[model samples]
Target: MSDHHIIDAKKMMITLEDVNKWYGQFHVLKNINLRVKPGERIVLCGPSGSGKSTTIRCINHLEEHQQGRIVVDGTELNDDLRNIERVRTEVGMVFQHFNLFPHLTVLQNCTLAPCWVRKMPKKEAEELAMHYLKRVRIAEHAHKFPGQLSGGQQQRVAIARSLCMKPKIMLFDEPTSALDPEMVKEVLDTMIGLAEEGMTMLCVTHEMGFARTVADRVILWIAGKSSKKRHRWSSSPHRNQQGPGSFYLR
Candidate 1:
C-alpha cells in the first residue's frame, strides 16, 4: 500500500464504550467496549445469538443500541439523523445474503449507491463501479443480472457495490456462510485483497483459516460480552486455554 493509503497508527477508527442493547425483555448486547484503529482487520466470532452481528450492526446504527457511545471516524452515533447518515455513508456493510437487486445488472447494482447516495454523475458512477467490479474480478459480468450469476459471483458483486461507496470501514456479517464450500475461497480471497489494501474491516465470520491468515488480533465473544483474553494468529485455534468460546479476529 502507498503511504497515502497507509492509515495513521495513532488515530482510532471506531470506538464503542459501554455499549448496551435490548430487544424487548432480552438483553442482546451487554456493556460492550471496543476500540479499532485505522487499517485494522478485526473479526467477530462466536456461537449463534452471541451478539456478534448485532454489535457490527450497531456501529452503523442499523440496529440502534439502547445505551452507550459509538464513535465512528469522528462522529458520534446517536439519535441525530445527520450523525447516522454520516456514519452510514462512511461504513459499508455486506450481509450474509447477497442482497443484490435481481432486476438490475451487476454494473447498475454497483452504481446505484454512488449515483443516488453520493450524488455522482451516471458516467462517473459507472466508471467507479467498473473499477471496483474489476478489482473483485467480476467486471466481465457487469451487464448480467444478479440472478444470472453464481452464489460466489453475486457475493463478489455485492462486495464491489460496497467498495464503490469508498467507505472508511467495511463490515461483513458471515459473508461466506451462504456460499457452497467450493465457493467460499473466492470470496475470502477478495476480502484478503481488500485487507492488503489497508481497509479497516470488522468481519463476523466462523472461517478460522481466513481469520488466522488476515487477522491482527482475535477477540472471543461469549454471551453478550467480549472476553478479556486476547488471542493472536500464531496461537493454536483448537486450544482455547481460557475456556470454551468462539474466537473473534482483530
Candidate 2:
C-alpha cells in the first residue's frame, strides 16, 4: 500500500459475502467473497475464464449472482431500482472495448451521462467533461469522433468519461486488452495518475507492472474462486513470475 493511500477498515466501500453465480448450470463463480475500502487500489488478475470479470460486473449489478450479498458504498445490491441506480451512479466502469457512442464527439460522450443522469446543465457538464479530458491529456481531441482517435486515445477518453461522473469507486474490466502494445502505456499512465490521487479502484488486467506500481492488494482468481491475495508491492509473487502459456495475462 502507498503511504499516501487512505484505507478505513471501518468504512467499507464494497463488500461481497458468499457470492455465487452460474450460467445455466455452468458454475462460473462459487462462494466468492471480497471487501474493498475507499482509496485502495486492487488488481484482479487471472487467465481467461477465471471469473475475474464476472466478479467486478457483479459489483455494479451488471451480472447478478444467484446467491450471496453484494453491498456498495453501504447500499445493498438487491432488486430495488433505486439502489441499483445509486450503485451505478456511484461506481463508474471502464471496459476493454472503449464503449463510446459512435456518433458522439468525445466531449459529447463524456457529458452525456452527467447531463442525463445527474441532470446537470449543458454548459456545466461540458466544463466538467473538459476538465477530465485535459487531465487525461486528450482535450485537443474533444471534438473528434471515437473512430478518429487511436486506440490509446479512445481508452483515455473512456477514462475521462468515467471520471466526469465523479464516482466514488472506479471499476476497470480488462481496460488494456484491446489496445496496441505501443498504445497500452498511455492508458496505463492515465490510470496511474488516478491511483496517485487516491481514487478507489478495482482493475481487472494482466498488466503486472501496473499492478506492482499502484496496487495496494493483488487478488488472483482461479477456477471460479479467489486463489490468493497479496499485500504490499514488494511481496507480490508475480514480480519474478512471467512467461507465455504459464497462466500469466495473455
Q: Backbone clashes in each candidate structure, one number apiece?
A: 4, 0
What's the TM-score of each model vs. the native?
Answer: 0.90, 0.89
Candidate 1 global TM-score? 0.90
What tens-digit string does per-residue lDDT give for candidate 1 at 99-149?
A: 999999999999999999999999999999999999999999999999999
lDDT of 2: 0.87
Query: lDDT for every model?
Result: 0.86, 0.87
Could you tell me the TM-score of candidate 2?
0.89
Clashes of 2: 0
| TM-score top scorer | 1
Off by over 4 Å in 1: 1-10, 232-250
Give the C-alpha lDDT of model 1.
0.86
**Lowest summed lDDT over 10 consecutive residues: which window, candidate 1?**
239-248
Task: Point out the worst 10-residue segment of candidate 2 by lDDT.
Answer: 241-250
- Model 2 clashing residue pairs (backbone): none
